[model samples]
Target chain A: MRITIDEDKCCGAGQCVLAAPEVFDQRDEDGVVVLLDAEPPAEQHAAVTEAAQICPAAAIALA
Target chain B: MTEAPAAPAPALTTRRAPGCPFDPPPVTQELREQAPVTRVSLWNGSTAWLVTRHEEQVALLRDPRISADSRHSGYPTVSASFEATRAHNRTFITMDEPEHNAQRRRFTGDFTIKRMQALRPRIERIITDLLDAMEQAGPPADLVTDFALPLPSLVICELLGVPYEDHDFFQRCSAVMIDTRSAPEAALAASQELLDYLEKLVEFKAEQPGDDLLSRLAEQYLLTGESTVDECAKQARLLLIAGHETTANMIALGTCALLQHPDQLAAVRDGSPQRVAGAVEELLRYLTITHMGRRRVAVADIEVGGQLIRAGEAVICANDLANRDPEVFADPDRLDVDRAARAHLAFGSGPHQCLGQNLARIELQLAYPALLRRFPGLRLDRPLEELPFRTDMAVYGLHELPLSW
Candidate 1:
C-alpha cells in the first residue's frame, strides 16, 4: 500500500507517529503530517494502514 | 453604522486579589448569580470582561468572533512577564480557527473517545504498575513524584514517541514556561533549546524513519524536499509542551481533590466501574484544575449576559464559575458523584472544548481508583496547609503532595 498525507489538512498532532512510526512523521515547525514512505515494502503495509486509520485529521490516505 | 451597546456594568472602582490564585474569590459565585457578565480588572492589573453566567459563558466560548490569539486582540500582558507562559500557550489553545483548526486537526485522533477508550488497557496497566511500585516503596512516599506526576508524563511521552528518559529535559522546559517569576528571555531560551533538539530528531527520522510520530512527520512533511529545519523544531516544541504539562497538573490536582474528600474517595474505591466513572466526573467538576478562563477578543459589537461588549474588548470566560453555576447544577457546591456533571465546562463546552479531554478522562478513571484501593490508608503526610502549593503558576497545583499509606 502507498501512504499519502494531505499537508494542507494535517495538524501535526504526531498521532500517526505513535500508531506507525515507520510510515508517518510530524514536521516540528509547521506541525503538519508528512509521509515517510510513499509505498511501504509489503511487510510494512500494515503499519501504513494503522497510520492512515489513527490519523485525527483524516489527512492520511492509504491506497 | 449603528451605535454600539455599552456593557451592563458601571465602571468598577476596587481591584484586589480575592484569594490565592488557586482559590477563587467567594464572590465569583455571586458574580454568576447577580451580574453574570461584568467588566472587571484581572489580578495582573489588566482590563477584561469576566463572564460568570452559564449561558453567557457557553455562548462566548463557542462564538467564532472571539479570537484566542493574543497578538490579534492586543492581550493585556503585565509590565514584565516571563516568556514561558506565552510560549506554553501560543499553540492551538491560543489561536483562532483556521490556524487553530489546522493545528488541532493533526493531533485530534489521540483525543477521540474511541481512541482514548482503545488506550484504556494501557492506561490501566500503567496505573497498576505504578501502584505496585508505590507499595514496594512503602509509607511516607512522595505521591507527586512517584505516581501522580510520572504516570501522565510518561504516558504522553510514550504517546508522542519521545524517549521517556528525555522527560527531564521537557519537564524542565515546562517548568520554566509555567514559572510565575520566569522572565520572557528565560522562557524563550528554554523553548529554543528544546526546539533545537527536536529539530535534529526530525532530521534523523526523515532519512531513516522509525515507527513513531516524529519519524513519520519527519519523513512525510519535514523532509518534504522543502521546509526549513527550524520550522519542524517549532512544531515539535508545540507538541511536547502542550502534551505533558496540562495532564501533569490534572493528575496532581485531581488526586488532591479526591484525597480531601475521602467519603467520595471511598465511594470511588468501593463502587463499580460505573461508580468510579461518576466519581471521576465529579472530581473533574470539583477540582476544575484549569481554574482560569479562556481569554477571547471580541471581533465586533455583541451583547452577552445582558451587557453590550464593544468591539476589541477582552473577555474572560470563567470555567470555574461555569462548573459551579447553580441554575444548571443542583447543589453545585456539594460533590455529588451522580449529579450528571457531564455538561460541565471542565473540559469546556462548545467548539473550543479541550482537545485532550478524552485522554485526560481515561487517565483519571484508570489511575485514581487503583491509587485509592492500593493504599486505602493513604493520607496526607503533612497537614494540608503545609503541603507545597503552586498558586502563581498558569496551571495551579501542589508542588509536592506527601502521602503516607
Candidate 2:
C-alpha cells in the first residue's frame, strides 16, 4: 500500500495517526501530516485504507 | 422557468420527543425519510434548506462553496442571541479558508492525537482525584457538579493557563453564551465579558509567560503582529468554552445513558482500553450532544440529493439526523458499544470538524472506566425522565445528573 498526504488540506484532527500510527504522524510544529511510511507493508493495508476513508479533510490518499 | 409559489415551510425546532431525550426531534426523522433536502423556516422567519440524510449532509459539509461564516447575510443561526453575538465572537471556526486553515493550524499542534495521548497520565490523575473527592463526600452526589463538569473544566483551565478557581465565573458566562433562549443583549454581554477576561489573561501571559497555550499564543502570535490581543483572546475564549462545555455534556449524558443500559455499562466498566475506546465512539454517536445542526450559507449554487440549492440560501446540516440514519448503522437507534461506529458525525466532518476531539476522547476514555471501577455500585439517583436536560442550550446535555453509589 502506498500513502500520500496533502499538508495543505490537512486540518490536523489526527484521525490518520489514530488509525495507523505506525504509517502516519503529525508534524510537531503545526500538526500537518508527516508521512512516516509512503509504502506501508501488506499487514497495514486495511488500517491505512480506513485512515484514508475516515480522514475528515480527505487529505490522505492511498494507492 | 416560472414556477408556482411554494407553501411556507415548517420551522426547525430543538424539541426532542417526550421521554426520548436521546433521539432527535421526530420532525427531523420524518424529513430525513420524506424530503432529505427540504426547506425549513428558521427562528427569524427566514427559510433555509435542511439536509437530513447522512450521505447528502456529508457532501454538503465538504463542499467548499458553503460558508461557515455567520456574518454572511441569511446565515441560519441557532437563535437571535447567536446572531447578536456573532460580530463579537467570531473565531477560526467561523472563518473560511485559507484564513481558517492558517488560524486553526496555530493551535493544532497542542491538540494532536499524540499530544493528547501523552496527557493520559495527567488526565487519569485528574479523574482519580475527582473520583476520590466524590467518594469522600459520600453517595447521592450531583455528578454533574462533583465529577463530570469539573474533570474537563480543570483540565482545560490548566492547559489554557486560566485559573480553575475562576471556573464558577467562566462557567456562568459560558452558560449564558450557549443558552439559545437568552436575550440578544444578554448573549452579547456574556461573550464580551468572556472576551474581556481572556484579553486580560493574554496581557498577563505576555508579561509573565508560562508553559501553556495562552502563553504560547502571547509569545508567538500576539507579539509577532500576526494577531492582535483581541484576536488572541477570542481564540482563547473559543477554546475555553468549547474545551469544557461539549465534553462536560458528553461525560454526564454518556454516564446517564450507561446507567440505564446495565449490560452496556458492564462492557464499558470491565472492557479493555480498545473496548472502552470503541464504547466511547458508540456513545458519542448515540448521544451526539451538538443537537443544533451545523449552520452554513451557500455561496454558490449546488445540487444535493436531487435538490438544487441556490446561492445566498442558508443551509442547516442536521448532523444528529445523519448520525442516526439507518443506512449508516443497522438498528440506528440502538446503543451497541461493540459496533464499528467510528464513522459517526458526532464531531462533524470536513474542514470544520471539532479540533479538540482527540483531547475529548482521551478524557472520556479515562473518565468512564475510572468512575465505574472506583464505584462499582454507581447508579443514577433520580429517574432519567425527571432529570433537567439542557434543552434550552445549543448543545444538548443534562443540567444535572444525580448519582449515588
lDDT of 1 by residue, B1-405 (tens): 223226544332221143332345555655666677776665455577778866787777767777767775345442234423453445566677686776566556545545567778888888888888888878888877888778887777677667889888888987876665677788777777787778787888778776666776676567675446675666667667656666667677766766777777788778888777767777777666666566677887778766888778888777877777788878887877766676566766544566666677778778877888888888888877676766556566778888887
Q: Provide per-model DockQ scores.
A: 0.07, 0.81
What TM-score results for chain B in every one of the models?
Answer: 0.88, 0.98
Q: Write the per-residue lDDT of candidate 2 for residues B1-405, one digit (tens) a residue.
A: 222129888889878888899998887788788777888888899998999988888888888999999999979988999989998888999999899999999989999887888888999889989998999989989988998899999999988999999999999999999999999999999999988999999999999999999999999998898899999999999999999999999999999999889999999999999999999999999998999988899999888887888899999998899889999989999999999898889999889999999999999999998999999999888877899998879889999998888
Candidate 2 residues A5-41, lDDT tens each?
8999999988889888899999988788899999999
Q: What is the lDDT of residue B268 in candidate 2?
A: 97
Best by DockQ: 2
Instruction: Please state the error at residue B255 of candidate 2 in Å.
Output: 0.5
Residue B214 alpha-carbon offset, candidate 1, angstroms: 2.3
Candidate 2 Cα errors over 4 Å, as ranges: B1-5
In candidate 2, position B164 carries an lDDT of 95
lDDT, model 2, position A37: 93
